[model samples]
Target chain A: MSVLAFPPPVESEAAETLRAEVRAFLADANAARTPLERAESWNGFDREFSRALGRRGWLGMTWPKEYGGHERSAFERYVVVEETLAAGAPVAAHWIADRQSGPTLLRHGTEAQKRAILPRIAAGECVFCIGMSEPDAGSDLAATRARAERQGDGSWKVNGTKLWTTYGHEADYMILFCRTSGTPADRHEGTSQLLVDMRMTSGVTVRPIHDLMGQHHFNEVHFEDAVLPPDALLGTEGQGWAQVMGELAHERSGPERFLSSIQLLIELIGALRGSESLAAQAAVGRLFAHLVTLRRMSRGVAALLEAGDDPTTHAAIVKDLGATFEQELPDIARSLVDEEPDLRSTSDFAAVLAYTMMAAPAFSLRGGTREILRGIIARQLGLR
Target chain B: MDDVSSIIFESAQRLLSDLSERVSAGRPMADCERADGWRQIEEMGLPFALMSEAQGGLGLSDAEAFELVRICGRNVVPWPLVDTMLANRFATQGGAAPAEGPIDTLGELTAEQKERAALARAMQMAGALDVILVMTISHVQERSQFGRPLAKFQAVQHSLAVLAGEVAAGQAAAEHAVARLARGGAAATLAIGIARARIGEACSKAAAIAHQLHGAIGYAREHRLHLYTTSLWRWRDEYGTQTWWTRQVGREVLAAGPDAFWPAVTGA
Candidate 1:
């Protein structure tokens, strides 16, 4: 389907009011942080900041109030997310739980699991990590080699490894995607999701994987014959493939996909505050054009998510388009301003540029690679 | 987007489908004045659709009123509907009576006229790009190469995906500006500038990929492809050359400065 087939987004007045509230909160919260620190973007972890957001009822903004949520519209939650991302607030501590895990539990989790985990997530006291990507199964997720089998007594034994599990060591639980009944070649037939409680489960090991920027944003978790109770199964047997898709639809659609580099754009504008160069103005204006359009598309997908429709196809398009915008940002900055990129540079422009230049490559590589995303879009277009 | 827009959209589609059949039977819309189509259109009062209700027109928002213009673009209708709608609305604003018939595509425009015309051109180009994508997707799916449909190849699939992105983004930029056009402020000015600039870029890139994929048939005058590509080429240059608007947007945005920039985008 054409992307124009998406419904036009209309934000309520209450959502805008919530936006102003978020902007005010961020101005105070982010005041003391350095530009270089702000350049850390979404991965800046501050547990206190996460808890503060919970106090403001920004966490779990769309879930049931009975689950410690405020039950606001998704647009309001969207407003809060865009503002925090624009401000470069340290939001990683509660990002995963707030964005996907709580919603996943509310969808496919056992009633007991939702009761046990949902409130703590809403309170920002719990952090969640995804356990989908294994070393052998990055893009070909169905090739997942991780296994969890039933014991005769109704317990479970988990084995194999999960790669690139972001913040796994720090997370309270992992919604693991693994094989239960079939061999590795059985792409979709035998997979199931199990909620691995890092504290409660035995034989779980998280080995850090430092990226090229020397950041510890990802890890590999190994389950060496890990033991779990009967209640660990997340959804139903043989439904992990479908359940993981639901999680990914949530994973991909959000203001974070596009607003991750607002700080870079801000600093670029600040540095060239009064320049009359045609190149600078046209370049910045072009960036704004892309931003405005991307925001509209992303908001449309948010509306789809809010209305309880599966937004996988539209979300992939947004994520791909947003990644292109983000990946191209540092080059635009370098062209407009004459600053050399340096992480320790005294100039905020230089430092932020340096940070973005290093981090920009991951924009297209993470979540899902660009090639993979385009294939999804192609299939949606009926090319497959 | 809204009910009125969809209503006009469906009406336009039906009207154009009937007229296109007549053209296919050799009464090409370009050859004759096609006064019958014009009369039907005038009955719908599309010429003054942008004017407020007091001005003897449907009081539609700029984006809503432009649905007729977009449909005209999609069908490559041989009329100056875009220019007429824009001129009529502008005439009412200037204390002149709304124009009775089609307006000139060539004439020096006032400052405000130029901005509105640029937005109108972008809207038309957006629609043309959409239809071109539909045509190209069908061609790639049906045409064979090396014993397989072209779309079955990974290379063609990736290229078409890129084309779809451009089409989607171009339409979005135009829709955003059209929604802001009726407001008519500094924000509107910036929005129009963005649409004109970005859609021009999308047009260039999208046309290239689409034409390449269609190969020889797309380049021939006999094919329906020229009907849209020619319009895309002409519209991007008519109101303001893409180069001129790109620079204007650049200078104006810098003049607005960074602090005012993001707020302008979000309209907060």
Candidate 2:
């Protein structure tokens, strides 16, 4: 079907009002922190800042009001997310929790779990980390060796190591994905997710792993027989693979996936205003075209999501193309600019360029690698 | 826009589906005699929709026309809906009686009148045309660059794409203007300009791709694709070049400010 056939975004008076309010807040925040000081992924984890957003009912904007959400439309939440990403706000504190965990809990958590956690999560008093990737099992999540054995006392004992856990060290809890039944060869079957309290866990350790940019944004989390109540199991047992995959749709297809390098591009264009070189012009033109196409594709996916469609294949397409553009931005910037990009430079342009250069590699690797994404696309096309 | 559009779309879609069936049943569009093509369009009453009820038309808005163009583009109909609409609108605005039959517009000109006349005759051969529109450019018959035809240059190809885009945009705009004029609104000059710009770009791009793929064979008569692609090149440059419409719309938009540009171009 033609992309244009998709319903145009419905104009909302409430959304427009909220957008204006968000613009005002961003204008103030931009003046204060100048987000360029933060990491490329909007990495300042300010609990207080998150709480402020929560107070305004912006964090879990689309969740049910009974679960401490505003019950706003997904498109409204999309506007907020897009504007936030574009402004480069310090949203990392509530980003994962609000984006995926909140939605997942709403979909599958018990009444008790919802009453206890949803309000706290919406209020930004608690934060969560996804514990799916392991040292041996990265993109191949079905290969997870983490074990959660049922205890006689009606609790579960979890023993596992999850690698590349973003914000794991500071998280209040880890949504642990482990094999609860059957053998390793079972792969996708016999697995379940147990929400383990990071504070109460007896043998839980989080060790920071510095990245190539020397930022301790991710960690290696080890759990040794950490006990959790029976109620800690999210949704049904042995459905962890399905739940995680659903949660990934939220994680993978978002404005954050593509807009990370946009600020740098904007800054680069501002700097290139006077240059008349053919290469520079063509570079800008090519980047603009790619960006437009990406927006069209991404918007199509967003429209589908709003209409309550799965759009998994379309999301995969967006991620694949978005990754390509993200990787190309730095290369284009490097050739366009005459000066060397320095992270410590006082110049905003230099700092943005430096951040994008360091951050571009993770664009495809994080969430899912480019090769893995293409393999998924190939499968969707029935090539495998 | 909502209620009227839904009805128009529903009805037009049914008609287009019926047209598709007819085209698929061993009857190519070119096989239809010129008079037959004219009769078919006249029965559709699409051309008469350009003038007001006072001047004989069912008044429709520019937005409606845009929707119709999108529908037509999606189906790839070979009718001269765009060219006829432009001719009718220009005639009505110029206080000339709207042309009775299919009035086609030409975009390119060959050196000799005979060649031009032959091209016109071919268009007539395919279907009846009341009028033909044409544009002229300097000939590059024997020029070579880097031991090849100058037309084979990458830069030349890019320029052609831009030209095609301009033509497509104009054709779309002119159709839109006709619809708006039928509704007795002030002429949608700006919308027409925007469409012209976009059409020019699309046409040029299509032409360049065709030429690049065809190489020397593109200019040869035996290659049927040239009939469409070359016409696109000629027609794209005829109504208004990309630069011309771009400057016209750009100046209007600048005068109106950034906020008003969209509304002006969209006729919202």
Candidate 3:
């Protein structure tokens, strides 16, 4: 059996410098946000706060300066992400764009597309969404029946429905993956990624899909004969399957994978502050231990990505372990204290507890489900 | 993975593999003199690998030392080699003469030494976890019950999955500690605390699941599985217990105030 290997740990020289800058900015930016607002985690969207981060050049720290980025190292960008997630920064507006979309575009986008979209994304004015999962396809994305037919003048007509598109209703663009040239038997071969401009595209509809927590962060997008120019295709035609796999590596291994419940954890620590609950103290310590381990692994994956390695299996492990920790935080908090969870309670602890209990169930399902992740890991172990 | 570490690890692995074969032939840990193994390790100069050149050592990196510890764990080495390695570093740093022979046991330990040793122990636990998991997976595939191989049972597969998770967590925790020690930064102590506590916790879950998966045979004195699990039990309590490290982390964070909680968690 092949064992998993994480690259040796890395401590960047830029960690402290960038950490201080991010911390100083977060202190004032988060001054008025409530515990519940912070409880929203990265799902908390604030346009002004995102714009402010862009102004400070934190949005695309690893990209080139000519693209309106700060031209910082990946480690510096990692520091920004870790600090932002820990403080529960309202980064959802630019989160998808900055995390995976921008990176993917930089890797495979046409030069013209990069010039037009990269600067706006870096400025936090352009938000992006993934358009991979369709009504008939989720984890098994190859089952995608969405078709793009080539039209006159080398353009294309796209028709399909994408589901569970996070921030799609508010997004400015989508990296749409659809079938271009082969039958379903071709599976991964016929797929291609198209850059769909949400603002300018006609016959496209976005319907909000409120989560169980009553939050409208997800959407269902319908592309009814949406017309796109030839330059819209990312990378090459029939290479979207490979391209998306590379993008998934970025999506799966970020600090956001594990820090989704930091607000609950912070609130628990505050509630038990100076109390004589050894169990609570021990629980908090254990949670931090798991978190620290996950962060190291996540950072190791970041290093691998920065080194231009394909860490597909490594990223899967990080996400699976991260999901376990995120889903378990609320339960551990509950076992340590003896209070009823109440979202409206005067106690911030109870409110966070209530909120986290509702949100924890989605931690495993959101990025990539636990089942899909485990299958990948099992295959990596040579079990399949 | 460097030239120095690769050369040292290769030689040590060969020597340790020979020792493992001897132990596998039927000798228990109690029968093996601690000094005999220490002499071989000392001759290889592994205990002094992390000391400075002026102190007569190769002055290798912490990552090399960590790999050595993991190798020792994988072989189920009976001696307290990790403790002695740390003693050499501590003694040299304290301006005391480095011990020439196998160190019996350390006297009092500094906080840094304790944390470092705890990380080594965690790596040992990770190594033990690998052996235990491999053994159990094989056992479940071969052993049969209810007219079918044990591996055919859904419950057994799920149990094995949980054990794998614990193993993964332990390795992650130990690697994090290794990285922290290599950096030698201010956050090293906290990283060590987390490693000891998290790996210690994983050891418990791993041990139970391993024993359960192996059935009654795992507990037998004659079975090789006990060598790994028993060492895990000993290592989990040594250096620092999960409760001790946890309490230390808790007290430190709480004293920093609620506002510092996030920063403390992130080690920023």
CA deviation > 4 Å runs, candidate 1: A1-3, B1-8, B18-61, B91-101, B106-108
| lDDT score, candidate 2 | 0.63
Q: Report the C-alpha displacement of residue A76, candidate 1, in angstroms.
A: 0.7
Better of 1 and 2 by TM-score: 1
| Candidate 1's DockQ | 0.59
DockQ of 3: 0.46
Candidate 1 chain B superposition, TM-score: 0.87
DockQ by candidate, in order = 0.59, 0.06, 0.46
Which regions of candidate 3 fall more than 4 Å away from where they truly are? B1-5, B25-63, B83-116, B133-165, B178-188, B208-222
CA displacement after TM-score superposition, residue B262 of candidate 2 (Å): 17
Candidate 1: true interface contacts recovered? 0.63
User: Which candidate ranks first by DockQ, i.e. highest?
Assistant: 1
Query: Residue by residue across A269-356, what tens digits does model 3's lDDT show?
Result: 8878886678767777788788877877788888897888887777877887888888898888888878999999989999999999
In angstroms, the error of model 3 at B4 is 4.6
CA displacement after TM-score superposition, residue A148 of candidate 3 (Å): 1.4
Q: A307, model 2: CA deviation in Å? A: 3.9
